[model samples]
Target: MNFKDYIRVIPDFPKPGIRFKDITTLLKNGPAYQAAIEAMKQQVAELEIDVIAGPEARGFVIGAPLALALGVGFVPIRKSGKLPGETVEADYDLEYGKDKLAVHKDAIAPGQKVLIADDLLATGGTIETTVKLIQKLGGEVVGAAFLIELSYLQGRSKLGSVPVRSLVTF
Candidate 1:
């Protein structure tokens, strides 16, 4: 399927000179949403994924369903203090400053294989920080998946050896 057809692109969104790719259009369409997740599932079908991890908000939308499709558990990587109990945190540089993400200290077991999923891969800061949190807990990152990727941002470069798959790119 032509996934881009289901996405809405708004120019100068959130800032001037920026075009935001919105997946809410596709997400609202049952067929398109299912197809997108199925397509992403196929992309990582060969990976040894014990669990799927995604950042808060949009990432949860993609990752949870993907995990269900793959028959694996889903873990949420949230902003600091969003999670209860003990947690592991990683700080990453934002465009203007630094922000932190945390996962419950016991969310990922040592040596478990994990696949990171999100709605987009832009500058890679979130995913990079997610990788750190997983590694800090001794979880092996097997691959990363996305619904859309801003290739010009070169976010994948920051992931090092972790493989990546995206259903759509802009």
Candidate 2:
């Protein structure tokens, strides 16, 4: 399937000189969304993943279903304080400043295999921080998956050896 056909690109969104590749168009279409998840599942099918962890908001949209499709548990990695109880947090640099993400301290049992999922990979800071949180809890990050990736930004390089897969790139 030509996944790109399902996405909508908005020029100068959120700021000038930026073109946002929006997946809501594809997400609203049941068949397209299903196909995207199925394709992502296939991309990581060979991995021995025990759980899928994703950041809040958009990450939930991709990770939850991908976990269901892969028949694995899903873990939500959220902004600091969004999760109650004990949590592990990692700080990352944003365009302007730093932000933190957290996960329930017990979300992943020690040594459990994990795959990070998100809507997009832009600068890689978010996923990199997620990787830290997972590792801090002793989860081994097996792979990272995305619905879209901005290749020009070179976000994948920040992930080191962690394999990354995206349904579409712009």
Clashes of 2: 0
The top-ranked prediction according to lDDT is 1
What local lDDT score does residue 52 receive in model 2, on the 0 to 100 scale?
100
lDDT of 2 at 138: 94
lDDT of predicted model 1? 0.96
What are the per-residue Cα lDDT tens digits for candidate 2 across 86-113?
A: 9988899978999899999999999999
Full-model lDDT for every candidate: 0.96, 0.95
Q: Model 2 Cα RMSD, Å?
A: 0.7
Candidate 2 lands at a TM-score of: 0.98
All candidates: TM-score: 0.98, 0.98
Q: Model 1, 1-103: lDDT tens per residue?
A: 9999999999999799999998999999999999999999999999999999999889999999999999999999999999988998989898899889999
* Worst lDDT 10-window in candidate 1: 90-99
Error in Å for residue 107 of model 2 = 0.3
